[model samples]
Target chain A: MIPTISVFEHSPDRGQGLARDMSVRWAFEEVGQAYEVRQVSLSAIKQPAHQALHPFGQIPTYEEGDLALFESGAIVLHIAEHHVGLLPADPNGRARAIMWMFAALSTVEPPIVQREIAMYMEHDKTWYEKRLPLLEDGIRVRLHQLSSRLGKADWLEEAFSAGDLMMVQVLRRLKTSSVLGEFPNLCAYITRGEARPAFKRAYDAQLAAFIGKPPKQAN
Target chain B: MIPTISVFEHSPDRGQGLARDMSVRWAFEEVGQAYEVRQVSLSAIKQPAHQALHPFGQIPTYEEGDLALFESGAIVLHIAEHHVGLLPADPNGRARAIMWMFAALSTVEPPIVQREIAMYMEHDKTWYEKRLPLLEDGIRVRLHQLSSRLGKADWLEEAFSAGDLMMVQVLRRLKTSSVLGEFPNLCAYITRGEARPAFKRAYDAQLAAFIGKPPKQAN
Candidate 1:
């Protein structure tokens, strides 16, 4: 049976492909896999059924037969592990690739997400101006380190793997921020990732949701 | 040669084991593996050598043979994959275990880290009082969801896998928070994890660093 994944009924990201579901969709597209989507309303996500599939009550979650998994990183990883294209064939290469995934999620994404939270919730607070710069500086520190590491390299490592897939997507969250343009190589790196056929397929597919022109389901 | 993982030369967490390296040490103990430590100071980590080992220039980077990896989640995962005790043998169960790891790191850890950042960097700001509640509430939402999912379960799954290992460590960050006292089941869950012999060994090993009673190396 084909696997099914959950997505927002109406993403707060406005189909900018910023929704976590986009990563899972991108993963599937990269692997040339066809899957089903289960659109979940925000209120419905907190309900028992969705909670059973996802303990945290978030999207996107993956389910194939008896296996139900949550967290976009895990979902993307599940796709990468099961598929041939998204991971390196060598053991060490594969481990390095997975390490980059953790780096993207655990290390890089947190500050960006925090900045968004501050901007969204605390924008009107008195400390907004004071705090915003610190948050941006936090992002800058990570980006500088990442920029140094990514210097003159196409992918993070030897070839494009799930690591690049994760890192590129994480970095994309900073698209709205002015700091991303400060690093030209990183910008080019993201450009390279976006130029990929799989990324285009994924981006367009998610964008289609907002435009009311979602691609036809494979099922 | 045995692997060597990096740790802070002088950890801000002192001997509390809140350091990310604690998780790696705990994983090593859980798997009954021998590994060395390379203490990295705040200034030293910013240097080229350490940056080469870890792009983000953070502590708890693993160096085994030609492979060097960073990110506590990735390091713990590497240990879990190489060693049998930390993961279930079955594929589906293994995936579920890993899914929990992502949940802990991606979904659960962000807010906790944000709260800590606020307390550390923004406590002097005017909005500290105003913003603190929201950060704690963010954590509360995740904890409530987790508590409901956990209920009275001894572990997240049938057996304690890396997922539980990660989730347990992530939750430990809130030990000082008043909010944690509100969830009895989650508290007990952490207690069960800390009660493990492996955890005790790891705790003592890190605690030894602050007390200058470092454990003798196995190698």
Candidate 2:
């Protein structure tokens, strides 16, 4: 049986494909793998059923046969391990690619996520406006270092591996912000990632799922 | 030649073994692998030399032969991949073990680090005190969910694989805070992990390095 992944019933990203599941979807497309989707509502995510799938009650848990996994980065890695296209065949190349995956999730994403949390949850607080700059500055530090490292390279490595997919997904969070614009190369890098056929397929699928959803009728 | 990991010449954790390097060291100890240490000063970390090793210029870059990798999670996984004790022999179990490693770093550690950032960086800001509880609450939500999942279990999984090693390291950051006390099971889990001979050996070695460091000469 093919893998099935759980996603938000109505994604908070409004079909922009910013949710964690986007990476999983993108990985599947790159690998020519077929998968099913299981949609869970925000409230339903915390219920026992969802919690059993993901202890943290977050969406984008992957299941195939008896092996189920949580964490988008891990799921992507698993798909990359089982699939041919997502990772380099060489041992050292594979290690570095996986290293970039950790860098994307562990190092780059946290600050961006912190910024998002402030925008979403802390905006009404007295500290909202004051804290926003600090959060943005944090994101800038990571982006600048990443931009410097990227230079003229099209991807983080020799070819577009899962690392780039993960980094591109993480960087996509900054597309709306002026901060990402400061790094011209990074901006262009994101464009290249979004331009990929696999990424387009995944993005279109997630967006279609969101738009296909019927708006809730008034009770 | 044994792998040599770069660590902070003066660890920000002040020898508490909370630095990112701790995971790499602990992983080495767990697998009974010996390693060398290369200490870099704070300013040195941002220089091109360190940058070449880790684009982000973070500590805990592992180097052996031609393979050099960064991100503590990735380094630990690399070690686990080559060694036997850190990962289960089965494919699915190994997959889940790596999943928890991502969960610890990507999910669990971010909130805790956010709280820490505020404590150290934003304490003087006008919103510091006011914003503190919001961050703590964010952490509490994760801890509560984690506590529930960890109820009566010694680790996140059946055996002490790399997953537990990573999770315990992430959770240990909370030990000095009041928040971790709310969940006795988690506290016990940390205790169990820290009690391991491997963990103690790694902790002692890192701690010794910190204490052994000579104070900077006065101008």
Candidate 3:
């Protein structure tokens, strides 16, 4: 049976892939997994039914048979584990790929989230002028470390696996900032991920969902 | 040969297990893996040597043989994958558990971190009062969903696995807010995890490291 996942009925980002569900959709598409997207309103998400599947009442909950899971990382990881394309075959390489997955969510995403919160919620605050730089610096520090590790390598580690997929998604959030432009190689690297046929399919799929329509008729 | 993990020589949290390294230590203690801690000062963390291991220049990088990894979730997940006690034998069950690990870091921890930033960095802002409540509500919404799902269950899933270890650690960050206390079951759930001998061992070890001495010359 095809697994089912949840997504916003009307995304807050209009048509952007910034919502968490985008990652899951991208992962599913990459793995050739036929999945269903259950549209969830923000209000319905907090209701008991949704909470049962997702303890945190967030989007991108996955269900296959008796197993129900939440968290986009977990959902993507599950897809990667069961499918062939998302991870490496060698044992040590596989473990390293999983590490990159964790690094993307835990180490890299936090500061990006902080930047969003600051921009959205703290713009009017008296300290906004002063705190913005610090937050930016915090993000730069992580990026610098990442850029250094990434160096001239195409991906965070060898072989673009699910880890790189997730990392690219996280870094894409910084596209509006100058951080990505600061490192020429990282910018090209992100561009490469975005240019993937699978990523394009996922991005267009999410954008379609937001517009309340299917993909535009192909030329 | 024993695995080696990285930690702060002098933690900002002083003796608290709030540092990311604590999660790695807890995983080691749970799986009965003997490990060594390599302490790095804040200055050295920014240096090239440390940056090679952790691009983010954060504590709790893991190394076994030639492999090096950063990100606490990645490190802990790595340890869990190799050690039997942290994951389940069932494929579906194991995947669900891993999902909880991501949920802890990605969904749950973000708002809690926001609360911290608000409290510390923006305390003097004119809009602090307005912003704090919104952040708190954001956290509460997640907590309420989590509490309802937990609904008197002993753990997030079937049994206590690495997922629960990470979840408990994430929730513990909100202990000071009284938001967790609002959910009686969740509060008790965190306490139960903390009371475990393995958790205590890890906590004490981190505490000892921070206090610049052994665990208070245990009674």
lDDT values of the candidates?
0.90, 0.90, 0.83
C-alpha RMSD for every candidate = 1.5, 4.5, 3.0
Off by over 4 Å in 1: A214-219, B216-219
Model-by-model DockQ, in order: 0.88, 0.81, 0.69
Per-residue lDDT of A113-197 in model 3, one digit per residue for the tens? 8888789977887768877887888788778777877889888667789999998999888988886788787787889888877
Q: Each candidate: fraction of true contacts kept?
A: 0.87, 0.89, 0.91
TM-score for chain A, candidates 1 onward in order: 0.97, 0.96, 0.95
Flag clash pairs in model 1: none
Q: Residues B52-147, candidate 3, lDDT per residue (tens digit)?
A: 887777788888887777778888888898888899999988997888888889888888988997798778877688778888998998887778
Model 1 chain A: lowest-lDDT 10 consecutive positions: A210-219
Model 2 compared with the native: what TM-score? 0.96
Stretches of candidate 3 exceeding 4 Å from the true structure? A123-131, A215-219, B123-130, B213-219
TM-score of 1: 0.97
Q: Please write out the lDDT profile of model 2 over residues B57-95, one tens digit for every residue.
A: 889999999999999999999999998899999999999
CAPRI-wise, candidate 2 is high
Q: Give the higher-TM-score candidate: 1 or 2.
A: 1
| TM-score for each model | 0.97, 0.96, 0.91
Best by DockQ: 1
| Index of the highest-TM-score prediction | 1
